[model samples]
Target chain A: MSQMRLSFLLPLVAFGILALVGGMALYGTLSGSRDPTQLPSVFVDKPAPQTNLPRLVQTGSTTGNNVSVTMFQGKPVLVNFFASWCAPCRAEAPALEMLSKRVAILGIAYKDRSEDTTAFLQQYGNPFQAIGMDADGRTGIEWGVYGVPETYLLDSNGVVKLRHAGPLTRGVLETTIFPALEALGS
Target chain B: MMIATGLWRTHILIGLVLLNMAIGLVFISATTTPAYAITAEEMLANPVLEERARNLSKQLRCLVCQNQSIDDSDADLARDLRREVRSQIAAGTSDGAIIDQLRAKYGDYVLLNPPLDQATLFLWLSPLGFILLGGLIVMMARRQRGAAIATELDAAERARIEKMLASRDSENRPKT
Candidate 1:
């Protein structure tokens, strides 16, 4: 009788475990850390991809000016991919502004018109030291960008230390970005 | 009778023709590929290269859509990736190299079919594990049920039951 009772209870125990696992997965998804959007970047700890793009031409600047990844070597820099059309890019403007005081930031205007980019920056207050124009988005593809407003932190030697897929917020800056920057002693 | 036989043969002929048509329809539908997202401008002029690109595109996931393959998605990124794949094929890059380059950039998540690795081993084998677990549970229950049906009484219990039955039999016996 005892053996029979144990056998009958076995399936109940299995169901309890399955339900617990499912509940934890749901809780993790709801809490935002396990969001589908926050995929870990494959470029972390790897050398930054080669980047040579036309500089976002300003009203008085020459068209021949270009920006490349090598130019930011020997000092920690933040490579932010943003677009004038992306709403989150606008949202993150203030955080980027604050971060610029501590670290050098290079902006890549992803797949946006120069005029629009110039307009956005004028409205948002430009914080980047320099900006690149990724007109056709080939450079964005090379950098493995799935969406706009992605940011990568590169160490002084030009290796990618961290990548945040969405807009930078105060929580993100405090929890993830600042710690990563401290790790590199930037 | 001869006329009836001729009509019967004609009916059989019609039936055979209908069956053949049904088979033909199934074959045609099975062979047709649904090229949902490929645009005319994205197709290569070279047929061989275009075929290679199409085959490769089916393997890549559209990161924007997350569920559909790049070949099936109409998103902008998917279009750009399709163009990139075509250009690589035109440049004589091998299929493995093209996939590897993308995998290196996007990680294993970009592959529509996840590669078998240490991390994915349990995922691939989970069905087998579940089936074994189910079998074990069933076997245990069956063994327990068999034991219940064959449950034996101890010597004292068996003797007491027999004695009661014997007494009842005696009480029912006719007075002689």
Candidate 2:
């Protein structure tokens, strides 16, 4: 081939290679694996974290009620993390209320004011046995809460049996939580 | 001359078109689908649980992409990370533990919003530093140019140049 032809062809070939490599690199970077492989549940096969939260029945009460890990003992319990401001929490409330009748339900109000939580529960129809106000979100962090509306299913022994990250819908309650509860025998 | 100019104009037009097309393609690719896509199956076996898992996944950054969450990244490594998150959640791991494990494996870069740390100080400050450096260089160059223009010739050199110019002008004048 002539020098001029070769020069023209060289750039076209270079551009082709550049496009291929660049495209693949972008796709690789964008499509790479990000699965959480190493993060182990501190609560898995372990007892629930201890919490002391004020009962929201009274106003201006700084003193909190003691809730031991044993509260989740014997009967299977579903511990839900929620906040009044979270929209997904509102969406999941009805499904959670329905699940409450089937299994014991406990609520942890993450980083929410007592009054707001009480008002939310009242509005949404409180289905929890004991509602713990996690005003600081320290308890939520311990339980591995990324956001509101995370649910954890505990076995009769208070060991964490399953965890759901987002809002609990009827499908999940019936398919995953119910099956696990059934396997645990009630 | 007109023909040559016309040919040159044609070449320039072609070059401009090619450059514009390349730029357009780049913009299109950038604005398209997110870098990652977290499937419902990868997030949760139960259809009801998928939405919750997806929400959490969207908040957590992919270690490789740094800017994109695992839910938006489509990289192979991101897929693996998504699967890993699913497995952990399936195994009943908490959210804190999952984030901690990612931080441990990939360093703080895994977090979309990396914690304020010494290593990341440059990432935050480099743009400002570059702007300052460019301004300083421009100022220094302007100062140098101003100084060159303001520089005065010594008395002896000025007189020598004037004499040379006078001699040249006299030589160039016609004898009258």
Candidate 3:
């Protein structure tokens, strides 16, 4: 082959290969085995982030209770990010309520109003042991919450066991969340 | 009876038209969505800090939006992130330190351009690896193609053919 032909063919071949690989990755993301919603967290198996959210008005503990990392010590806790405005939170409200009967679920009202959250919980059933008001969403960011309705299963050591995105569906709870909690022990 | 049947058909036709219109309206409303861009009013007061925030925002992915950078996404989380970036910049935090802090909290996925780490080593190098492999394959193909075209006449083969031709000519000359 001529030198010119080789030079022209090189980049073309590289581009073709790159395109094929990129297309496969795109396809894998869209329709294949990879779940796009779950951004694999580094916080898993690491200590739960430091949080200092004010107590929700409903908690009314008089102790000035704030949700903090220390709360997860010596016990597995389910920390969930939720908002009244989130449609998926509404769907999972009952599921969370049912799950709460078995384990401690800590709720952080992500960037939501206290009255709205109170109404939402009253309308659906209050499932959280302690509800923290993440008014500015800074606490949510600290916990690496991407969106409302994300739940993290924490182990006794305050290390995150499993982080789940989206609403807590019955099937997901049964399969992943429950198993993780079960492994963490009561 | 004929008049009644015609009226009944008209009613059914109108129902169908309304049904189609409703579906068309829903589709329009669903698909005519516009993407949200972060507002200019969210800019930092210091031009230098604002420039840094802008650049950093482009580098940071909107976790909730999944694909778009924080600068491009309209999600509340993205807005919060832009505010966070600006605040960090204003706080005199270095750009690398801010990005590292975000990566620590959100994992490597938070960065629009992920750094080459153990987990992302393959992801970063795969493009170069593919290019090299592609070059090798093209080179091999070129060599094979050249050899295939040259098969009809090599120096030794051409010399052998010439000798054979010379012998045949001498043999056919009636031993002159």
| Top-TM-score candidate index | 1
Instruction: Give the per-residue lDDT digits (tens) of candidate 1, residues A1-186.
Output: 778578678879989999999999899988766788787788999999999988875672427878998999999999999999999999999999999999999999998888899999989978899899988888888888999999999999999999998899998999999999898887
Model 2 CA deviation exceeding 4 Å by range: A1-42, A58-62, B10-176
Best by lDDT: 1
Candidate 1 runs further than 4 Å off? A2-7, A60-62, B1-35, B150-154, B174-176
Cα RMSD, each candidate? 7.2, 20.2, 12.4
Chain B TM-scores of the candidates: 0.70, 0.53, 0.63
After superposition, which runs of candidate 3 have C-alpha atoms over 4 Å from their true positions? Answer: A1-33, A59-65, B1-36, B152-176
lDDT of each: 0.91, 0.72, 0.85
TM-score of each: 0.84, 0.47, 0.74
Instruction: Residues A73-114, candidate 2: write the lDDT tens digits.
Output: 788888888888888998988888888888888888887887
Task: For candidate 3, write residues A59-170 as lDDT tens digits.
Answer: 4332365677577688888999999999999999988988898788889999888888888888888999888888899988888888888998888788898999898888
lDDT of 3 at A167: 88
- B1-176, model 1: which lDDT tens digit per residue? 99999999999999999999999999999999876899999999999889999999999999989999999999988998999899899899999999999998888988999999998999999999999988997798788788889979999999999999999999999999
Interface Cα RMSD for all candidates?
Answer: 1.4, 13.1, 3.8
DockQ of the candidate models in sequence = 0.48, 0.02, 0.32
Per-residue accuracy of model 3 over B18-115 as CA lDDT, tens digit each: 99999999999999876547686898878888888889999999987778999998888899999998888888899999998998889889988877
Sort by lDDT, best first. 1, 3, 2
